[model samples]
Target: MKTTSYISRQVENLKPSGIRRFFDLAAQMDDVISLGVGEPDFVTPWNFIEQSFHALEQGYTSYTENAGMIELREEISNYLSGSFQLDYDPNEQLVVTVGASQAIDLALRTVVEPGDEVIVVEPSFVAYVPIVSLAGGTPVTIQTKAEDDFKLKPEQVKEAITPKTKAIMLCNPNNPTGTFLNKEELQQLAKVIEKNDLLVLSDEIYAELTYDDNYTSFPSIEKMKERTILISGFSKAFAMTGWRLGYAAGPADIIAAMVKIHQYTMMCAPTMAQHAALEAMKNGRQSVQEMTESYKQRRNFIVSSLNEIGLSCPNPGGAFYAFPSIKETGLSSAEFAEQLLQEEQVAVVPGEVFGSGGEGYVRCSYATSIKQLDEAMERMKRFVEKRL
Candidate 1:
């Protein structure tokens, strides 16, 4: 018998999430203003919680269908069509998953055979590359530069394409950076996608949190729906991070493949969450708008404060993050994040953990309260003034 370690090489080599590390560190300390975790500060709305409680009282605790309840699927179908002009058959084209993260995993596993090259744009979420690797695919990166506003250009996609290229993974109103590609930009990228015959995994979890009308759903483009797997969830816009609910809509055949894997691995999303999500889809627009407006206010304040504090930050169009360059502090992203946490008791994530093009910057999520943000900014200013 061959002697080898019990743990698979793939699992063993995976890096711990940098975001989680800082979040945990902050959790252990007192009086730490946390801008490290990318979660909403608002609690899940009471109405949604009430719906879940009602479901439980009605004894609806059993597992749902592997693809989720038919009613929830229909609501999801209607949402995409009405919001993004993307149509998908509820029965054959959509499958609710544990979260958008799980949907991303299932989508990659369904289509990416071993040796397939998945083009990943960075600085992106830390999970994208690792998930691609776990699905037995290679992650080819396209580095979006800060000077260019971190937009993914068509020529960059064209240059990254290879014969083995399977798909491109994108996070619209992207995490860590909060940079979103507008309609014109998507049109240009669509040209390259059509030319290369590639697929797209569009993660639009923050779709409803746009600061303006600049956000464009990827699959809404001409003929792009057929080649795209649209992943979204209630975590961001609806303040349902703990609910563990998300869904994917794509081509029927592709969805079926994903459902097959999901059935064996996850079976179905939480029945209670599915019920709450149904309520959210039916009557949660007002709440969403209110939360979005608050985030916009925080975004403005944070960007203005970061600039005054000697950190150069871009105005993020959407999502609740402020990606500020800490280069002026004469320290790397990790160094800045560490010293800030130690000295000022402000927790922000080091940009390097998000992959290439992330160095020299830190991702500070403005998803917390205005008062916390104000104090964190003051502490950051004190820290940076000493070095500058």
Candidate 2:
């Protein structure tokens, strides 16, 4: 049989991750200061790690309930309610997922049918469109503009809707750009969503990293809880990326559908990770605050530095990324990223990898230490100057 014939067209046609090629190239280089990665650089708090060790020592190594351990789920419920005013029943409205990435996949897979359309905001995380396609839905994209500070407007949401539209995917404090929506902004969009009778796959993985008090949980909007699948996790805020633990909470029926699919594929999130996340919910506030402060400082510095270097970046209100325009250099996003890497020993992700509306820019993660960021900025300035 021909290889093409044996493979599913969807799997075969799926493009390789645009971010991976940059990472692969960086890995082969020496002494490269990388701003390409999106994860928090902070080590997982020792207390949380110790708690996981305790769980393992106590022989809690077996698989958890497919939805995850009750204790962890309860903690998640309490935490979300306390922090974001999102009330969920641990038993029926929550599922401990392998990661927020898995939660996004589960949410899409649960609701997206062959002809359904998901309206995806552009310059989003790389996974959203592909996951929508894999879930058998079409992704209708709306490109947010820099002139509007990259905020998706209520009008755009209203315009994107059609009879077949099933949902809208939102990454508040969006990746690559780090643009966050305030409560009022989300409410305006919420009105449109409510009118359209559409579901919401709101990815708030970076929710805890917002620099202001304005970050609003989408499901917490009036009348939105029933139609929203709130996806989040411990990876970004708690520095628990390796734990691979996340969860989704929404209407009980939607959550049940996700859990059913999760049960077959993952069985359960890692037990030790579930235990660690329990501690994270209970006592990880200090670590999160400290890291958020550190990130704030780095965010301030990087945005200022990029502007001074003439990259013209908006001061992102949340997350650790700085998406700065490289258009002045008169090179494509890919060209600027590749040439910068070859010229200066720095690695940053080209913005084009993110989605439409990301060209002429590059995403530099400030998740690293200030010392490294200072050096990377200097290197980038030198490279950009030569190009100009």
Candidate 3:
């Protein structure tokens, strides 16, 4: 039998992750300065790591409850309430998953019926489109622009709505763009959602990474609590990317439905990781703040440097990426990325891979050390000068 014949049509239809492709190419080249990775370069905080070690030393290697350890859920609950004034009952409104990625997938798989239409704001996370497709839902993409700081506008959401629209997936402090949706902006979106009776999947994994202001949680919007599923995790903020832990909070019914899928598929999040997360939730605030400060400094430098090099980047309000326009370079986003990699040995993801509005730009992650960023910026500057 042909290999293609054996593959599920859903799986076959999906394109390989564009970000992963760049990483693979970068791995083969010597001395490549990569700005393509998304995770923090920092190690997991020492206290969190110590807690993980203590858990292992005590032989706490058993499975957690299907919904996760109650203590951990309580910590999550407290973190949400304390940090964002968002309240969720730890008992019935939360489900721990392998990571925020799994939380997003489970939420999509649980609520999306075949042919359901999901409004995806772009340039959004790479996973949203494929996840919606895998859930047998059709994705309707609404492209946000650089002029508006890439925020999803109420008018755009209103225009995208159809009778089939089931949910809206939002990535605040959005991946690639690093743009956040403020309170007033979310309120405008809330009105449209209320009128249409739609659900919301909010991916706020970068909630703690925002600079200049605190993050506004989707569920914090008046009357949006029951309709929103807030997805967050340890990966981005705590620098625990490899630990693979996350959770979802929302109405009990929807969370229970997601937990049903989780019970059968994942059983539960890793027990030791949950223990570490417990520690993180309890005392990791200072570590998170220090890291966010470092990222803010890097963000300022990168945005300044990119602009100086003739790439017009709108300063991102949150998260650690710089999305700089490459339009003036007279190259398509892909051509700019490819040639930059080949000539300058610097790897950055082409914004075109992010979705429609992402064309004419590139997403460079500032998650690495400043020294590496400095080297990459210098290399990029030389590359831009040559093209000029």
Candidate 4:
């Protein structure tokens, strides 16, 4: 008897995350120095962790409200108002999610109809395209140029719009490239969006990590708030990735739809995480400042070292990555990264993983310690010297 083909076409067609391939490869090699991961290397703040443990010890492990614990939601509302001058009625406009990843997934699932177009900026986090695709939307990639420091220009956004365009996915202080979209730049896109009547899926998970400029929120622009779904989490800023706590704020109707999806799909975010996040909202600012300062130092060191080694890296204004052009090395980004990992035992992500505009570049994360960064830089220097 012949066996049936079990895999769904969607699952078969989906590309595995390019970022994970290098991680799997590096795991087998001894002495591999990985600058490939985008996560903060810092441990979660002690007070936050302790709070979480205390909650669990007190048997506060039941499921939370579908919208999350009321106290946590209130804290999130206040935090957003204080940080970005954006306000949302937490009781009506918020849904607690498993992570920012889940928040993005829920947003797309909530709004996108089949064959809808979702505009994603290229050289972005790898998940955006796949998430849109899985939600039955076509992922329309808009390539942002390195010469513009990878900012998504208004003209490009305008050209990508179509009647089928359901939403625009904006990742400010973007991953891989670390390019930030300030208020002035965001206003341009906001005008186009307003004109087109398109929805905005604004992923501001890295909003608090900006180095040189005040980070801007998409919903803060006049007339854009009602049309925007803001997704953020305690992960990056408060070192709470493992807590799996994130929230989305938007128009009540949209958030209500997302809450339904979240209720059925996840039931709720972990209850202990929700309580700990409330504590973090009250006390995590000092820890955030300390971690940000460390990342700033590492960012400075890696950018300078890469430039000194003949890689043309623009100093990123935010996030913990430095994207450097590797054209002078006479190798494609993938080949360069592979050869470097094999020869120098250093691992960095090739820019192509981030999509089309990312070719001929590599993304190095500075979330690790200075000592590790110093060693990685020396390894990179030796590798480039031989090639150049």
Structural similarity to truth (TM-score) of each candidate: 0.98, 0.98, 0.98, 0.98
C-alpha lDDT values of all predictions:
0.93, 0.93, 0.93, 0.92
- Rank by lDDT, descending? 3, 2, 1, 4
Residue 44 lDDT, candidate 2, scale 0-100: 98
TM-score, model 2 to reference = 0.98
Residue 281 lDDT (model 4): 96
Q: TM-score of predicted model 3?
A: 0.98
Worst lDDT run of 10 residues, candidate 4, spans 1-10
* Residue runs of model 2 more than 4 Å from their true location after superposition: 1-4
Q: Write the per-residue lDDT of candidate 2 for residues 1-388, one digit (tens) a residue.
A: 5677888899888998889898888889899999998899999999999999999999999998999999989999999999999889999999999999999999999999999999999998999999999999999999998889889999988889999999999999999899999999999999999999999999999999999666789999999999999999999999999999999999999999999999999999999999999999989999999999999999999999999999999899998899999999999999888888988979999988988699988999999999999999999989988877
Residue range 1-388, candidate 1, lDDT tens digits? 6545877999888888877787777788888888987899999998999999999999999999999999999998998888788788999999999989999999999999999999999999899999999999999998899999999999999999989998999888999899978999999999999889999999999999898765679999998998999999999999999999999999999999999999999989999999999999999989999999999999999999999988999899888999999998899999899899999999999999898699999999999999999899999999999999
Candidate 2 Cα deviation (angstroms), residue 155: 1.5
| Candidate 4: residue 384 Cα off by (Å) | 0.3
List of clashing residue pairs for candidate 3: none
lDDT of 3: 0.93
Error of 2 at 81 (Å): 0.8
What stretches of model 1 exceed 4 Å from their correct place?
Answer: 1-4
Candidate 4 versus the native: TM-score?
Answer: 0.98
